[model samples]
Target: MDIVQTQDLRKRYGKVDRVCDLSLHVPEKKVYGFLGPNGAGKTTTLKMILGLIHPSDGGVTLFGQPMDGKNRLSLLRDVGSLIESPSYYGHLTGLENMVVAARMRGLGMAEIDEALGAVRLSEAKDRRVREYSLGMKQRLGLAIAILGRPKLLILDEPTNGLDPAGIQEIRELIISLPIRYGMTVLISSHLLSEIDQMADVVGVINEGQLIFEDKLSALHALSQQALAIRTTDNHAAGELLTAAKVAWQRSEDYLLLNRLRDDNVARLSQILVAKGIGLLRIEERQSSLEDIFLRITGGAVSL
Candidate 1:
């Protein structure tokens, strides 16, 4: 089932287009990575879906129903979101903060403890939020977001300030949401590595437009693989490659070729050996999620 679907979704501010003709499909019981460079309108699109901001044109269907002013509140009852940054009062204790959120959502107090436990914040529940470390605060934010166990979870940069261990904990927690509680998740992060590991599907947005949306594996497969070859005689190898008219680039230590198929590798190896250019190592290198993302976004590096 598609938990959230947007058709030609557009958002504009005066003369600028924040999101243009973006169609997003978020499946049920899976994590959908909403990827984009900074100021690429990811947050804007999310806000439109949550009805926090109105779209200039197009429509949004969430939970199998149109997301309009009339039904937004009812629809949001089954959704939990932490956008941009989590907001909490500095003076409030962690447990107190959860209590206030639960009360607003009409959730049971028991859920507060469960939420805190899920984020590994139960031990620090009594600490004032102001005293909590950045990572701890991030976890507390997550705890509050999951308080009601909403069917849908939308988290934007949820691990923004976490340490390595905290990142792994949150990653594991997110990956388990579907199997453990059947929750559909839509997450946006600047860290492509995190998205690569956590998301089943991804949507790449740039310049207020979606450039690609598909399974993570499919996106990876779309990138061209390079064959990295290290030879004892680098000059001879380059000369041979140039003579053969094969497309290659010479790095300081190795020759990088675009032809990476098994046949191509075998043929290249034979040619190099026959020419007495001893091959030390040859390996096929697939592009990382970051590489693919930069390529799709016209080399716009993520902040």
Candidate 2:
């Protein structure tokens, strides 16, 4: 079942379109990555879905009901969201802040503790918000979002400000939410690596247009593969590859072999062996999400 659906959803300011005619479907119990460069209307589209803003031309449906101004409370009750940056009081302790939110949402301390534990911020539960790091603040915001235990969670840039370990922690947490708690997630982020790994499906937006929407692997598989081979004898490797009829290019001390194949590698290795070329390392690589984004958007959007 589709947890969210948008048909011709559009938003504009004067004559400039912030979000063009966009349409997408997010299945229930799945993580959908909403991707685009900076100012790709990702956040704008998300706002419309959340009923925080009005749509200029089209509208959206959440949990099978038409999303509109009148149904805001009913729709919002089942949804929990964190857009842009989560705001907190500098003087308030983490637990106090969460308790305030819990009371407003009519929840209890048990719910607050669960949210804190979900983000692994239980140890810092008593720390003041002013003392929290950027990553800790982000996680605190996440704790509040999960406090309601809503059916759907909409998070924008969910992994921002996290360390390597913290990033991985949030990644696993997001992936496990649906399976462990029956929650549906819609996350928007500029980090393609995180999205590629976390999202079950993805929607690419650029210049306020929904350019592509598909499964992460499906979109990635549409591009060509490249191989990065590291060897000491770059000159000799290039010569051997050419003599073996394998196409390649040089990048510093590495050789980039386009359309690299298993058979091609075997043949090239044999040629290198005959030429006495020293072997160091060999690995196949595909065009990364950033590569695909550049190819599709003409490298207009900044990272």
Q: Which candidate achieves the best lDDT against the true structure?
A: 1
After superposing candidate 1 on the true structure, give the runs of residues whose Cα lies further than 4 Å from its correct spot. 229-255, 260-282
Q: Residue-wise lDDT of candidate 2 within 164-262, one digit each (tens)?
A: 988888899899899977999999987778888899999988988888888888887877787878766888788777886778888777898886568
Worst 10-residue stretch by lDDT in candidate 1?
Answer: 294-303
List the candidate 2 regions with Cα displacement exceeding 4 Å.
226-286, 301-303
Candidate 2: residue 248 Cα off by (Å): 12
Every candidate's lDDT: 0.89, 0.86
Q: Write the per-residue lDDT of candidate 1 for residues 1-303, one digit (tens) a residue.
A: 899999999998899899999999999999999988888898999899999999999999988999888999999999988998888988999999999999998888789988998888989989899999988888888888887789999999888878898899889999988898889999998778888889999998888899999999999888777888999998888988999898789877989988567877888889889888899998887877677777778898483
Tell me the lDDT of model 1 at 254: 85
